[model samples]
Target: MIKFAYTILYVQDVQRSLEFYETVFGFTRKFITPDNSYGELITGDTTLSFAAHDLAKSNLKDGFMKSSNDNKPFAMEIAFSTDNVEALYEQAIKAGAIAEKPAEYKPHGQTVAYVRDLDGFLVEICTPME
Candidate 1:
């Protein structure tokens, strides 16, 4: 049987990324490696993890494209569900996130907004559909 356990994002600073997610998304830290090279958060069903860039390089011989400090965000995005999209969107922006799109009603009866995290990762904050 196959089941999704977690998703790891390669970041320059594992602790920093972990803190940002904790502050912005209210996710609690599950644990961080003793070396501080990797960390994970308790994000509902699937775990959200972050690994240092050096750790990623050691894991992937071919290397991977990471979100740049000055370049635009990557095409992919991580979506988070919330009951109050507007409030959460505002909170995210205030927490050093860049607003990509303001909250708006969708045809599917969902309120959705977009923002870019400190690492230039696209994040979609939305309310669940009926």
Candidate 2:
């Protein structure tokens, strides 16, 4: 059976992206290439990887859409599960995340909020459904 191992985000700076995830979400930096072109975070079962924009360009012939400093964020998002949405949302903002929405409860029994990361990638902070 095929299993999901990781997801890579093409970023302008690998180290910076890794650090942002570390500071904002408490994820630990797992490894980074010596040239700083690739990195990953220790995010439990599925690894969150990052690749430098230049490296990504070299790897792809047709190129891929990516979130950028000047452009609007991509449609998709990465969601993180949390228990204390309010506190963690505030903490994420204080850590330099741009708040897109404050936490709110859904009929499904989940408290969810949205934020943009340093590179303008959408991130969702939400509580688990009971």
Give lDDT tens digits, candidate 2, residues 1-130: 9889998898888988898899878999999999999999998889999999889989999988878646777878888898999888898888778888999999888999988877788889999767
As for model 1, its CA RMSD to the true structure in angstroms is: 1.2
| Candidate 2: pairs in clash | none
The TM-scores of all predictions, comma-separated, are: 0.94, 0.93
What RMSD, rounded to one decimal, does every model reach? 1.2, 1.3
Q: Candidate 2 regions off by >4 Å? A: none
lDDT for position 102 in model 1 = 100
Highest TM-score scorer: 1
In candidate 2, position 63 carries an lDDT of 89
Instruction: Tell me the number of clashing residue pairs for each predicted model.
Output: 0, 0
